[model samples]
Target: MTLEKKQPTPTAKPTADDEIDLIALAKTLWDGRRKIMFYLLAGAILGLVFALASPKEYTANTTMIPQTGSSVASKLGGLSSLASLAGVNMSNVGDKESLPPTIYPQIIQSIPFQVELMNTPFKCPDVDQPVSLYDYYIDYKKAGVLENVKKYTLGLPGLLLGVLKGEQEEGALLDSTLASSLISLTEDQDKVVKILNEQISLEINDKEGYISLSSRFNDALLAAQVTRKTQSMLQDYISRYKLDKANEQLKFIEARYAEKKAEFELIQNELAIFRDRNKYITTATASTQLEQLQTQYNLAYTIYSDWAKQLEQAQVQVKENTPFLTIIEPVRVPLEKSKPNRPLILIIWIFLGGIIGTGTVFGQELYNSVKERWSE
Candidate 1:
């Protein structure tokens, strides 16, 4: 009993089933090496084809600081009344009444803005003169070899549907005529609008109060040109919104001034004609008529003069309200292509292939294991 008690208890070692078979795992991978290599080879070939086939693009961007009328008013702190005249609220220095920079992105995204951009003329290849994007897309552009292949292969379903349903005709989609109150977009126009939306972008930094407007295109010159155009349009739109109320007031004043001028002229002419006709007619009727005409003339003159002054002030207000979108970094032709990172694409495809191949090998292993157990 003493001898038996002196013997040490045996420690249980890990079972084969519980332990990771690293050597077996390596062997499994090694066995599927050919399959993995095939996938890798296929991936590399596809990546090379895609990289070569992809079109090149350039990005052009302009950074701007939105200097509103309020900014100007802040600089002229001495003139308290000047701020009010300039449509700047002294209490709130940011000119909150006007459209904020956040909404500027939406302005760029608007259908009207896209349509206007598409209609703009630019120099094109093989064309002697400038041509609009709409005309170029519809009339001049012919699909390339790769594009045709894609159209027939990847886009074959849509093509078949178009043939069966009758392809929608592409033509002038916008009506600038006064007769049409509603703005409608046809398929062709919608396609272009979508492209425009993708090509153009506006990023605003609220804290710093700055904006970045950018455009991308296949042509470097076109990318820069479009970016410049986009900047101009954005500035114009924001300025228009900023001074909208001031401009309306100016118009009202203008109309009133015109009417008052006409009335004043008529009254003056009547007074002159009456004086000329009755040069020496001295009677109660004549005296009363003269007095009344004189009164009318004075009243008209005063009103007309007041309106004239208001008209001038309103014009000043409109001018004062105009904002400056100070360009921080002007757009320039991009020296490098922005899209189709070939090496990255190739690496990604190769990595994806490796993953899929490893998964397939493991899956086959799992299926065989399950089948063996079922048969047993």
Candidate 2:
């Protein structure tokens, strides 16, 4: 009875390998503190240099709302008003656009669109005279220390390849108008386009149904000018596209109307003359001839009237399809630069350097551990 009343002894908890490994890792990092510090310091120094050497860039933005056409319900309401002016029932005509407002961003990305924008003259901070994007970037552009470093380091292979190939003759410059239609581009022109594309961007907000055009450049004035020009060109392009079909229809109808009216007038004059000449003549042939002239005149008059009405409708259609771009936020020259976030860049570099240094330390430790085990 006395032995059964004795309390049972408690078992001791087993030690975890994870806790030991964590302590060992902490010791290893502490031992390699000097190496890690060296890397961190180097990273900070490089970051500082890059931050100082980085070129300042200004960001210019413009937002606009595209008014394609009136709503279908409201469109019919205005048709009556338009019909009174156009002299046709425009109610049956449906609103149409070759490219909708949502496709506007794609239009801006087009090669022809970018090429046109590149050639447009803008004021650059470095130059006294206004220069095109191509001229400024290629001829008058100055490379910063950071740019040179990137060129010599990451882009070294490409640079070597270009050098080995040697310089080639420049391509011929074609007519700007012809180039747009043909989409012809020289090597240098293509290069400039790539650069320009990087500088400009278009963002469309579907929910709000608005567009934002942005341009980033070294010069504040140039950035704003490019953004404004891009917006204007896009709007103009869309308007012209929408008007193309309507305008063509109007021209065709107008031409036919003019032709029919001329025929109608000639027939009317002939009828008048025939009536005057055949007056008091009681012959079956004379009566038949007068009836034929009267019939010809009536047919021509009907055709001419119908064409004239169509001509009016075509004109109204053109006006209806004309797109209106309302400026939600107008482009403005940036007072301060938008890029070269120095502090952020420095932090990133330091963090990257620390990671590399830690990796190096762990790598060395692993190699030594393996070598010692193999030797044993």
Candidate 3:
């Protein structure tokens, strides 16, 4: 049986169907070149149209270096320990209260800040006259066709809901009286705020102690104005926050000083009257009365003097606590458009079109292969 099995075993040869043919695949793609080119051309044309229709935006930027008053910390140094012992926290003591540059972005995005910005009048190139940003956005601004298309497509649900709700009455959802409270925002106000938020940007460099503020708008001058206004508003807000305690102290001191001054003056007048009326008397009871009046005058004068010094000190503290914003690079009108990068847009479109065309060609091949297999 072993001798019979000594015959040679035949080796299996590879079949043509099992081998991959790159040339054939290439030919298949070449056969659909027209379809591929058509898709690519369509994509490119759409991109060009979008690029042409897109609105131009101008960006204006300003750089600033915040001047932190370390003197405030020094002034509060002695009080910090006392405050801690009394279970009262003091932030200004030992650089604790000094806001970091990072929080600046939050300040710009704050509701109160946005409200003020919206109410601010901006010079628009398209408009014959300057208009408040709120009015400009709400009344005059027109959405582009593409923007409307996107709204109807991606934002359809929201749009439909808004329509169902009907035109909201002014102040129906928002309490304008609470604007000073900053606790709430109305729907209209919120919309304007959101728009403002999109238009403004803040960049902080903590290590360098500098900040860059930027604003984008349809008009170059308006963009520059907005940037400058934002810087001013930020400076004002920070200054008010920094000097809050000092201002309160000053107010109290001023009120006390006024009361003391009036009391002192009244006492002086009384003392003078006593002296004038009792002139040349030379009696023990009269001398005693004179001494009593003199004593009262001295006490009132002393209290008034002390408060005067305190009032002066409080005034100094207010001045010292006021923060200064040193503008490194002031805002200027942009000469060039900041957005609508046409060339880049065109390139991206072409690249996407090529990808889509290639995918279409391969997808067609896959569909045909599946169909043939199913038929078999």
lDDT of 1 at 242: 64
* Candidate 2: segments with Cα more than 4 A from true spot: 1-16, 70-98, 166-181, 251-310, 316-323
- Give lDDT for model 2: 0.79
For candidate 2, lDDT tens digit of each residue in 1-376? 4666766544332244667788999999999999999999989998898888888899999998878654232433443453344354444344443466778878887898988888888887769898888888789887788778889999999989999997665434556566666666767788888888789898888898988889999889889999999988988897787677567656755775677678779898999999889889699999889888887777666656666666676678877745468899999999999998999999999998899899999999999999999999
Give per-residue CA lDDT, model 3, range 130-218, as digits (tens).
89898888888898878888989999999899899887665566566765554666676788898889999999897887889999987
Weakest 10 consecutive residues of candidate 1 by summed lDDT: 71-80
Model 3 scores worst on lDDT over the 10 consecutive residues at: 11-20
The lDDT of model 3 is 0.79
List the candidates' TM-scores in order: 0.70, 0.73, 0.72
**Cα lDDT of all candidates, in order?**
0.78, 0.79, 0.79
Cα lDDT, model 3, residue 229: 90
Which pairs clash in model 3? 91-97
Global CA lDDT computed for model 1: 0.78
As for lDDT, the candidate ahead, 1 or 2, is 2
Mark the regions of model 1 whose C-alpha exceeds 4 Å error after superposition: 1-12, 15-20, 71-96, 142-158, 167-179, 251-313, 319-323
